[model samples]
Target chain A: MMKGADPDAPRLWREGDRLHVDVRGLCCPEPLVAVLRLIDGGEAGDGLVAHVSQEPLLLYPELNARGWRYRLVAPRGDDEVALEMSRPRA
Target chain B: MTLFLASARSRLLPASVPFRFFAIAAALHVALWVALIFAAGEFTQFRGGVGHALGAAHLLTVGVLTMTAVGAAMQLLPVATTRPLAAVWPTKTVFCLLAPGALALIFGMFAAHVGAMIAGATACAAGLLLFAGLLADNLRRASSMPLVRAYGWAAFVALVLLLALGFALALDNSLGFLADHAGLALVHMILGAFGFMGLLALGLSHVLVPMFALSSAPKGRVAWAGFALAAATVAAAIIGALLGLPSVLAGACGLGFAAALLHLWLMRATLKSGMRKRLGLSFVLVRVAWAALALTPLFGLAALAGWGPGGTLFGLVALGGWLMTFLFAILQRIAPFLASMHVSRTGGGPALLSDFSAAAPLKVHACCHFAALAGLALAIVLDNAPLAALAACVGLAGALAFGLFLAGIVKTLASGKI
Candidate 1:
């Protein structure tokens, strides 16, 4: 059996002033892929936060290139830090 | 907002720079195999000399290995370091120098042409020096990822040593100035194969393997130990070779074996803990590469003990069985990956990686590659020249198949179908 395979990991949710895309158990391109999927599915407005377990910095290029603005937030308690992303108004 | 824009532009190079290197590397892969096919008779008995066999070896080393490393490092290393390349023009100029320079060097080595070898070697050196400069600049700015940074720094120092020795060896052919040409050559090979390429592979695996498998990165201490041991092994091996110390060389092999095993253990742990269970066909090749890496030190020990054909076997497995296989596997994934990223950035909507890659050519290549590795190893073991030639033919076919795969990706991109 694969270790650290959390099948029941949180996918995403919405809270006050932000839609939380929880990728806390994921790694690398998964986080980026999830974020991109959300953007592609017409969730490109302000207030989408992606919580990635590791290496969230790699997402910045793709985010910025796709016209999304992001600010990396430090972790709250034991949670992974969040990348809060939004497309800027013209 | 301003920071985001600046960061994005800082990290991204013109896609053409890296893609061009990849194109050259893919083409050269086929070219090297073709060269091997023609030189197959000399290949089995090759112990190191300037001829068809030497040409083929350089075609693989300078042309394919170095070229691919340059391309991948330029694009991926920056991302790992969180620093942009100094500029794109130097990279473009590197390809300009490396591509033709590699060809000329191969031609010179094959035909025993002194002037061409010198000229080609000089051009190649110049290109590599520029690359080293860029790498150093990027690494200096890399404050994070200390293990990766250490690997880069070590590879940089090794590059400097290899180039210096490489130039002397090339000149020795014409001038006979060096008293110990063979000794210098051994050190050059060690530094080139292990110090530069091996270190990069170890370091990048920490990031690349996990990224692909969607697993957490290996812990820092394990990675650091691997690096330190690998460095010690390479240094000890070089010293042993120069000073003719068998015990030291054997100890180096032992250290190398440990380092490789530790690395594979970490990779295994990563895979086990990975979110992505089915990593696809590319990873099969990666596994083969890892196995080859693990077995390389054994071959080295055999060579040190003066076993028949052990030295040749070590070279074959290290170069062909491990480095080539690993690079191709990564290339298989990255070409489509980078292309998808490019498409998305270019307003093509989220491009699926599967959309950019076709399976047929890759499958064909994978089959042929495995057959080639196994066949060549058997042929070497049995001292069978004809079988070795046949193996080279099989490898050539595989390389061609890989080329076709890359060409398909290019075509897909050109069609704006992403």
Candidate 2:
């Protein structure tokens, strides 16, 4: 799990075989930073989904460099944008 | 955790490349003022020939604007496109060729040496053509940022036209083959200033302004229309000038005004709604530049009307008031920002932007810059050489102050001090 430095940091949760980060209402670099934190925390297995209002373009290069792949996940409910990323199982 | 974490660094270039270009630009900034100071006597009456006025004009055009454009574009283009430049050597080579080439061209213009001018022009064209090639390749790959890409493409086209006309103008100096030397020269200036560098600056503003201000980026539809209008304006202006159509040229100015208005509205609205309540003194300079941009078309109209000193007013406002002012404002912010980004790449914690920035020098610069602009405008109105010379000194002081600000950033980076 990613640690939060602020009380208002994005909420994080886990659902079967996936970690979901809700970065709604947060600005750019914040969502990207949250995703990075998840990756650095070793919690990013094969299924990490980030919900953000803005497209996390900055994260794409980092994700690719780390052997991770991502695709946009159409919003369900109030999520403006959801990006799903994973490293393929060996 | 420290306040700053090293951000993702995939597309970022080795810091040295952009820094070298910037350093050269800063040095040339001082050189430009020095040239202006020397040419002040001839400044008002200078209708363009091989002299200090002409040399100084080239120094600012090639030396400062184009030099900074290349450097900033190389670094920022990748960021906008989310892809790294395919190769680096071409970029470094551009700097190598352009830096000396600008100096030689300026010197040649000063001395009226045809051989030196030819060699310098050849070198500059080679450097610019290579840069255009690199820009085209990168822009081609950028499918995501549509508005930015569109602006880039338009700017690229304008650059090609400018280069073609620029070469013709240079050759005409010696060969005397062309009948309409003045006509072609007018086209060359219009394309270089409003077409190439102008578009590039406008495009980059779309990216940089929102990012720095922490504002939402402008809506796509409005920005797209603005870009279209700007491109149309450039086309109309070039065609009008080439065909000797004054009314069509005025129409182009009208289009330019519409585009400028739209751009300013978007920027102003963004700034107003920004998360940042106080965007610092840099925005003050930016606002001033916007005002100057708004006046440029009006000044162009005045020039067309055969008003007193209209040509001089138009040139000063367009080049010095709008472009130069806006560039310095953005560069003030970008230099430290890039420095911080680079410092974070190293092992240590990233330097705070506030620590690296020295406010006093920026304040000094702002005051002096505005004074120089006003004084020069007044000098033209009065046809006073000494006043123009004095204004150049003020402008030079402002440039030096900016240099000190840059030096402060370097010192902060070197010492690794808070």
Candidate 3:
């Protein structure tokens, strides 16, 4: 489940109250930009899962530094890792 | 996310996938050219007359043109997005499929191999779908440059339409969807040439013309207008075709494309005014690109004027004259830029642009090549096969010279000028 930051971020999708974007096969800036666009559009919530490949080691630290609360979700037999991210309550 | 900027070595290497495909495509172009030359003078056996226009032209236009454009976009969009490729295997797979597929498709045309043609189209469409997936990622990213964004989006849509049209043509030829095949060739040209390739070129030129020249890009409405006019004109042309409205609309659209070029030329003038004072042969090459831009409109003029068999000449003007000449001009910049960037990133100091330029023979060849093309255009105007042949022979000489010059460039790069 993914989480929203501002609660005003546009809801592209909802797992109940959370905005989730399945960023599987989605590369950088794409995933981030889409999320930001939603946020900027007055949509926000919890459980924003940005599922992406963890091949680039450089990507994760940047996400963490941005204050995104993320949990890495790993599935069996798949090369991809899903980062379940949520915004803290303001 | 941080903006995507190319690393040193990455510049030299073709963006992981398309470079290999483009290489294969260029090889196909050269081989098809060879065949066209051989087919001339003594081969009446071909369904069409013996000439470069018959086989090589199709292969060059479709195989080389589309392949290179697709590959460049695949590589470049990632760079723009600051995104790495989705999957290496799929990218490689696409190239592997498209290369042999294009050849088989072309051969399939002459051999009446309906199955092969259908198979080739399927393979290519699959490859393009993969490419589109990658590009979609880029388009999703936020960019301040709306013109680039708009053009990128339209190019993808145009690509989808072009592929659909290609499928229709393939099915008609293979499955006999329409036995007569009404103006299918013209439709293919309109969609592929004007819609897909033209828009891609125009969009990318907005980047390349400025970047290589170290000039300020064309901003504001002029850039957007160019994109809008091209997209609208292409759509109108296609609509006119379907409606049986008038051939004149097609002429109008072509004139509109010429107008787009005129806009670009003016924008290029703007780029020039602000460029670094000590620009070199790359600048000269860019000027040549401008000259080619002029030819694109001249082609539209020739088409509009209803000159006899002039469409063929006009096609060459747009295809080889504007597109190929612009491609080569950019290549001259790209090749050296790549080498220099690689060397510098690894700690080599500044180097002269002339150090990498293809001097002597390549220069001579370029002159001959342009002259040969001009002569061929003139011959078509005169409707003289003998003169066309003479021009083609000269063209062949120029091609050989270019090949030798390319070898020299490689040699110079390997020598380490820094």
Candidate 4:
């Protein structure tokens, strides 16, 4: 679980081996930052699933820079998307 | 909404598309200062009409400001709206038409050549109309970012009017078709500066400022209210100009002041709430621009009241101090940001923004830009041509430094060092 985060910040929870972040209501860099925070905080092998209302186009470069790979996953509904991300293999 | 992975790549135009405009804008920035340096004497005494002063003004407005706006919008609007441009060729075509056309137009104004002026005006009108159409298409598709869309639509309307006015003014140079040339010229300036550029800057800032600062956009009714006031302000100012009514213009300025205050307050709150406290040197320019934005209406009121050199000062502060400064500030950031994005997409992992920026040149640029603005302001107030020339020299130096900063990015990208 994400700790001491703002109530309006993205909601984060764990599902077995993966962390899920609901970033639907967040704007711009907030969505990008939330995902970055999870990557920075988690263990090297931990995986993340981010739910976003808009596509995070700006986040791709940051993910690439940090050696993380991401792909679009099945969306939850008509207005939300899930992006699955994982650290690069050694 | 169905999310496509390919949408990411689609949203970002090829690096060449935006960078070409930036490169041309950088070159024209240098040319503008050089033109000013030569025309500094005329600049100090400039009471409208045509000549080198007019040419120099267009160099900044069309060559630098509009060029950069087109490039930035082409790249950014797509991403903001989550839609790719229908085609990239039109953008290239716009560049092809506007760039040389702007040069020809400026040259014609400087040399008093009607033929070049007419030819250039036709080309530029064609290019700008195409750009407006493309922008309209994108704005129509934008479901999110309602405030930005609203402003975009307003600015689009302003752009069309300005283009029409500009074309008529250009033709009037030879034909002498108008009874009140100066009056229409004033209307053209107001439409171009406040209507098109002002609204665009305000709208884009809502997105760019927050994105750069890592903060949420200033949302809710306050933001919407600011937009409403700004739009109304522009409309009132245009009507006042067209009718030659100082009282109406004064009222417009009052509305403009309120709008500026609301805008500055919103920006201040946005920065305060930003996660990234240190927004870097580019933000210093942005802050200066915001100050100019606040002062523009005050200057307008002074101009209306017939204060010393107030009319010229109003034009300078609004065009040079606010719009040009803001564009350069944003350019410094977005150029690198876009370059880095392109570099990242090239498969060898992401490129850092620092790798694309040269700090020393930018520092020199910032210092010299402020000095030139201050010096020019003083020169205009005192009607001192020598001082104006000196200020233009300082501005030229700053423009050179900015050009070097841009050059460094181009070099790095070309060298594949990023």
TM-score winner: 4
Models sorted by TM-score, best on top: 4, 1, 2, 3
Cα displacement (angstroms), candidate 1, residue B167, comes to 0.8
Q: What C-alpha lDDT, on a 0 to 100 scale, does residue B141 get in candidate 1?
A: 79
> What is candidate 1's lDDT per residue for B38-153, written digit by digit as tens?
88788777788789988988988898899998899888888666566877789999888878888888899999998888888888888999999999999997766677788889
Q: What's the distance in Å from true for residue B366, model 2? A: 1.2
Q: Flag the better candidate by TM-score, 1 or 3.
A: 1
CAPRI verdict (incorrect, acceptable, medium, high) for model 2:
incorrect
lDDT of 2 by residue, A23-83 (tens): 7655333455567767766877667988865445455545643656677655555436678
* Docking quality (DockQ) for each candidate: 0.12, 0.06, 0.03, 0.28
Interface RMSD score of each model: 7.5, 11.5, 13.5, 5.9
**Which one wins on lDDT?**
4
Query: Which ranges in model 2 have alpha carbons more than 4 Å from their true place?
Result: A1-90, B1-9, B344-348, B411-418
Candidate 4 regions off by >4 Å? A1-13, A24-30, A33-47, A53-55, A61-82, A86-90, B1-9, B344-348
Local accuracy of candidate 3 as per-residue lDDT tens digits, B197-244: 777777777666655444445665666667777778777767765554
- Candidates' chain B TM-scores in the order shown: 0.96, 0.95, 0.82, 0.97
lDDT of 4 by residue, B1-418 (tens): 1123645435788788898899999999999999999999889767688899999999999999999999999998887766578899999999999998999999999998999998898899999999999999999976777888899999999999999999999999999998889999999999999998899999989888888776677778999999999999999998898899999999999999999999999999989976568889999999999999999999999988888799889999999999999999999999887777555324455577766768999999999999999999999999999999999999999999999999888876675646
Residue B123 of candidate 2: its Cα lDDT?
A: 82
